[model samples]
Target: MNWLGWLHDFFTDPAHRSGPDSVLNRLLEHLAFSAEALALAALIALPLGLLIGYWGRGMFLVTALTGVARALPTLGLVTLTVLLAGVGDAAVLVPLTALAVPPLLVAAAEGVRGTDPDTRDAARGIGLTHPQTLFQVCVPAALPTLLAGFRTAAVQVIATATVAAYVGQGGLGRYVIDGLATRNFATTAGGALLVVLLAVAVQLLFSLLIRYASPRGARTGLVDDPAGSPALLKESV
Candidate 1:
């Protein structure tokens, strides 16, 4: 059969549409795995980034370490994780979370660190505490960069989550791996297409977020109106 014919069969195949191993189930599994890894990466990277950025300390070191982490091979990390932890979610999570951290950590640190010094001073002059200044001023200003990092990490994780199938975990990658192993061109194409579509959807979602969270957007009252922080500070005082 031609490539189109295989895709048609792959899509029409009732076996691919239902049951535990169905496309729908595997797609959900892929999303779940990506979400878990992204969450873990954010949980580890965000607070640490914020604290260091706020203090202007260790940001360089952290970014350097995560940069090295980014250079490590994802499949190698997964294999090592599997060997040590045994095959399960941990094997998938360890590598993907590591894959996700560099961008997130760097973006978080730089975003917060890049906050306008004048804005910080004004916030402090208005009697805002350090924590308040960080949250209300730095965080709001950092939204664009932070969201971009999240979007990048999210797309990377979704694309790489297929490795889950390598360790006997269920995900859309299963179709690709199984298809290639069995020389089922239709399944491989169909599975790859689904992943691309998913990554595109995430990219669009984050684009909307970054646009609206931007300073220009906030000035236009698009987001929470972070541009009006001075007025809010006066009100608080």
Candidate 2:
């Protein structure tokens, strides 16, 4: 069959749709894996990032770590992690979490840093403590950028989570790996298409969240300055 025919067959295959190892199941696994990694990354990155942005301390640390983390080979790190932890979700989580942190850290720090200096000064003048100013003033102002960062991280994690199948974990990637082994280009193409669709969905979801949920100032920072946000993400990535 031709490639399009393969995709149609892959989609129409009832066996691929309903079983425990079905595409739906694998997609759930993919989402779950990405979620876990993002949560872990947020825990590691957010507080430190907030502090760094608030105090203007450790930007070098953030920059150095972001660069080093991005440069780390995902497959090699996965291999080393599996060697150390011995094949399971933990092995996968370590590398995925690492993959996730740089964007989150950069976003958090940058969002907070992007807060208007005049607003910050006014808050300080009004007797807001440093912590109060950050939480009440800066955080609210930075909400949109923070959400945009998560959008970027989510897309990255979703695309990369396909690697889970490499460590014997179940996910959308299994189709690609298994199909490739069997010379089923159709299944491989379909699997890849699914990942792309999921990433786009995530991008759209975050865009909506940033639009309707964030403060006007926060939304303005993201929506009004299209060039700035991408540049920031580009630098981080």
Candidate 2 segments exceeding 4 Å error: 214-237
Backbone clash count, each prediction separately: 0, 0
**Model 1 per-residue lDDT at 129:** 98
- Alpha-carbon deviation at 78 in model 2, angstroms: 0.8
User: What's the TM-score of every candidate structure?
Assistant: 0.89, 0.91
Residue-wise lDDT of candidate 1 within 1-237, one digit each (tens)?
887888898999899878987988999999999999999999998999888878889966875777697899999999999889898999999999999888788778878888889999999999999999999999989887788788888999999999998999989999899999999889898999899999999988986777766755253332221111111111110
What is the lDDT, from 0 to 100, of the residue 107 in candidate 1? 74
TM-score of 1: 0.89
